[model samples]
Target: MTDATRVSPFLGLPGAVEGEGPNAGAPAHYGALVAEQRPLERGGAVVDLGNLGVIRLRGADRLTWLDSLTSGLVRSLAPGESGETLLLDVQGRIEHAAAVLDDGESTWLVTEGTRADEFASWLDRMRFLLDVRVERADEIVAAVGVFGDRELGAAAPNGVPLVWHDEWASTRVGGVSYATTDAHPGRDWDLHVHLLERPALEALAERVRVGDVSAAGIDALEALRIAAWRPRLARDVDSRAIPHELDWTRSAVHLEKGCYRGQETVAKVHNLGRPPRRLVHLDLDGSLGALPAAGAVLHVAGDPDRAVVGQITSIGVHHENGPIALALVKRRLDPEAVLAADLDGEGITAAQTAIVSPEAGHAADVPRLPRLGRRSG
Candidate 1:
């Protein structure tokens, strides 16, 4: 959220949608931000995602070392390539999420700002004998967001803007997914972050002033993300998180990667075990019920005293759809179950639209080898 000290470079631009709370200091709309962003063709919309933490990993062993710890094929990334990775705890619970892009010389990671310091400390402790030099790089380079197919209109680290293309918009290579929606809500949601500096910000500001690129705030950016069911660690993920619960295996968790901190639980959950909860999108009936805030408890239509079945993790106001939300609910809750969010003292109706299905364990489908070379008659 932007405030007195942390203002966006694009602040005070014409038609900016100023925001509050998580989007504090950021624009929610640019007068035309909502309408022009769908089909969202390419290269016009930009936002100051200064809130994200940028980290740089340099050294000969950087790639290999990162690959060893995170759920990504980092060692295989070529210059200018993009990948998403996750760090997990011993129990396979998600610890951190990074949108990564490599420029050969350095690996750039864009992550939640609040956890950057702690994440860096963890990396430092783990680099006992490695050649890796891990540290926060925001002071050297700022975080910027671009939502189109245009050239990154900023200074380049190596002929490019050190951008980390978002892969969560769709299923990526070497990953499994549970979303089966015929048409993904975010199919046109293409947003990436650029790591640059003050001069770059000036260059971007110049471009925006001439109508070269349109500007949107975190609110506009988030509404599209919610429409697509995209997950954000700061908003959707909490202390009790596991990759499977949010269907993150589709992009962040590489099931076939070498051993990492939480490999055992990741493998087990997708094979013999089931995620304790499932991710679901809710098209909230916004008529009578006010928008539920994060941590809002949910229940089956009229069952309040029956124990909370789930909680709202993220909420947004879609440009077209009145209000929408993503919630983590008990896995056994009927996909067709009528649900409601407790808003203030009222029960607002919601229709459950499943994202991760119960039958999502891709491990069960992993082809097995011949059993003892035995023949079947």
Candidate 2:
């Protein structure tokens, strides 16, 4: 569990609003949330991710051991390189996701603070005779998120800046994209995570306070994330979530990598079947003057009495796109269908845009063979 008593220095900045729930221990927004978003999207500001959990791994077997367990190709990751990986269950359901950065001597995994302890505990159980040693480094290091290619003077612990660049903007090597669209919104998404020590974090906070640097809150960052159709483990994942449903294979899963815990399921689903659900981007009706609450049931727009087809996972009012949301709907749902979210007794209409297409999966495209039958010639 995350330390509830831990307070971030970013919270002391002018117009800062303390976050709650999953965003606890961080600032939700500054006084001007919408205003703050524009700067962040343009790479003019940074978001404090100090609340995120950091885990450090040491020893010679660290990289190779991690490669055999997760869903990414990480054994060859060079020092200062960034990688995204997922820990999946035996059934191929997502268990954890991390932004990975290695510094030659030590490997760092930055993940949701709420799941840190459980993630670390599981890693410990799997370390039978490996040379690796896992330790929770939350108290020793923190993370900050930068929106673009701009540098923020990140700390270099082993002569390499401890930064993890997100690979969302393009298809990763050995990864396949599930989105059928020619232009992907994620192509414009540029995010970087910088790890820093306590003194550096405090110094960076001071820079924001004196107007020497700019800062945005998690709210702004979230809005942009939703607009980009990015799926976060904490928000978009459920008990049954597989990487395919969220199109995570584009970044986190290497299709040709050697077997891992869930390799069979991942291979079968990609070659012979489709994900049960598909992720979609929604343009919500803002005329009602409210955003649909997370987990609100969704139905076909004109028929509120119809069976629920999906639920809202993440919702935000984007600066450019008024009200937007990311949802996981039944795989068979029509891509052009108009949807509605049940807010109380009222239905707020929404236009659906496919992120993970209904046609996703079955990548191998094997052809059917003719069946032999007994006959007299």
User: Pick by TM-score: which candidate is best?
Assistant: 2
Stretches of candidate 2 exceeding 4 Å from the true structure: 1-5, 362-365, 371-377
For every candidate structure, what is the RMSD over all alpha carbons to the true structure, in angstroms?
3.7, 1.8
lDDT of 1 by residue, 183-263 (tens): 766666677777767677767767888977666667667777888888888889888889888989888888887898998
User: Against the hidden reference, what TM-scores do the models get?
Assistant: 0.88, 0.96
Candidate 2: residue pairs that collide? none
Per-residue alpha-carbon lDDT of candidate 2 for residues 242-272, written as tens digits (9 for 90 to 100): 9999999999999999989898899998999
Worst 10 residues of 2 by lDDT: 1-10
Query: lDDT of each structure?
Result: 0.78, 0.88
